[model samples]
Target: MADPDGNVARAVKLETATISDALDRLGIVGQCYGIKGRDPDFRMAGRAFTMRCGPNSTPPGTVGDYIDDVPEGAVVVIDNHGRTDATIWGDILTEIAHRRRLAGTVIDGVSRDVHLCRTLGYPIFSLDHWMRTGKDRVQVEEMNCVVAIGGARVGPGDILVGDPDGVIVIPHEHEEAVLAAAEEIEAAEDSIRAAVRGGMRLDEARRQFKYHSLQTRKDAE
Candidate 1:
């Protein structure tokens, strides 16, 4: 495992493997939803620096300007407040983001440049896809501020893990503890899996290892 500060510095270096391992161990949901009907396809790990914007606040120049400040490999998480009139991300910005080595982006509203983003192999999770530009409708209000996604409060420096499972925000203060707990959970699960493969019943393996008792042990420790 990487040091906390190192993990923080190389925020995008953490992989879906580590995150999924953590999620399995922790038994928590990580993905957020804004799109209706279908779940978004995203598979990148990131550290968030959230953004809040409203209609008429996110002009092209402003969006470009804000993205320039993001560190390399960081994921830019945005809360557009469900605005569907104007798109928050598009081709030009996506190109810039890729150049900056960003892991990906997640928006609580709509976005444009889907084909470009897809071609670039950059994952983008958004409310919807559109062709209308974010011209006079959106504006950037704040960066590195707390924003709500799928009812969860996300703050700057939070570990943003996304995969087919969706996105989950690991609080900055809880990162180390959560990662450690997740690791332990993965080890136990591996043992359980091996037992099941060797003919032990699933329930028997779980009971033998006290898998369900993890929370109590975690809390006590």
Candidate 2:
């Protein structure tokens, strides 16, 4: 999450777990399930550039050609209905995205050329990987549109935070409040850790921080 400015900001430190907790506090369902980072240490934060994929309408419908249109710092989120038999991503796309310095790509389908992604340090979160190409098996139905990732709807410009734990999509309209909630959750967890380090029992530290309420809904509170 480290921005180039070295601001030591929460954006550079919030984990998916904390963000997920924040979403819970807000009664939002956004955690993308089954998508895993290619590199466990990889982390990314950026606005989503969403696209939808569907079975080839024609026998040989071509795969998407929208990668060149993606802006820098935007994450590519594609919905392929969690299909692992066909891949919507490959080494060429990985190389190009790395060169463009895009945040990352999240796929509801598998990807090919996983080794290239790892070697290039290009971050990708996906259901799995395989050698099958998606060129004719699937095609982009639309771009900058609503898409699903692990059953979670994602739209263009939505904030995407991903890490080893997984990816979470924050609705654009709720970004501010979600960030605030996440920061608060992170701080409370830090306090609990600090107290534990100072010889307080784990239970005592959690109790002091009201840890159990960290993800409690605001309405319930």
Q: Pick the candidate with the highest lDDT.
A: 2
- Cα lDDT tens digits, model 1, 79-197, are 88877777888888889988888878888877887888777778887767888877666778788899977656688777876665456677777677666765566677789999999
How many residue pairs clash in all the candidates, one count each?
Answer: 12, 1
lDDT of 2: 0.86
Alpha-carbon RMSD to native, per candidate: 4.4, 2.7
TM-score of 2: 0.93
As a whole number from 0 to 100, the lDDT of residue 217 in candidate 2 is 97
Please give the RMSD of candidate 1 to the true structure. 4.4
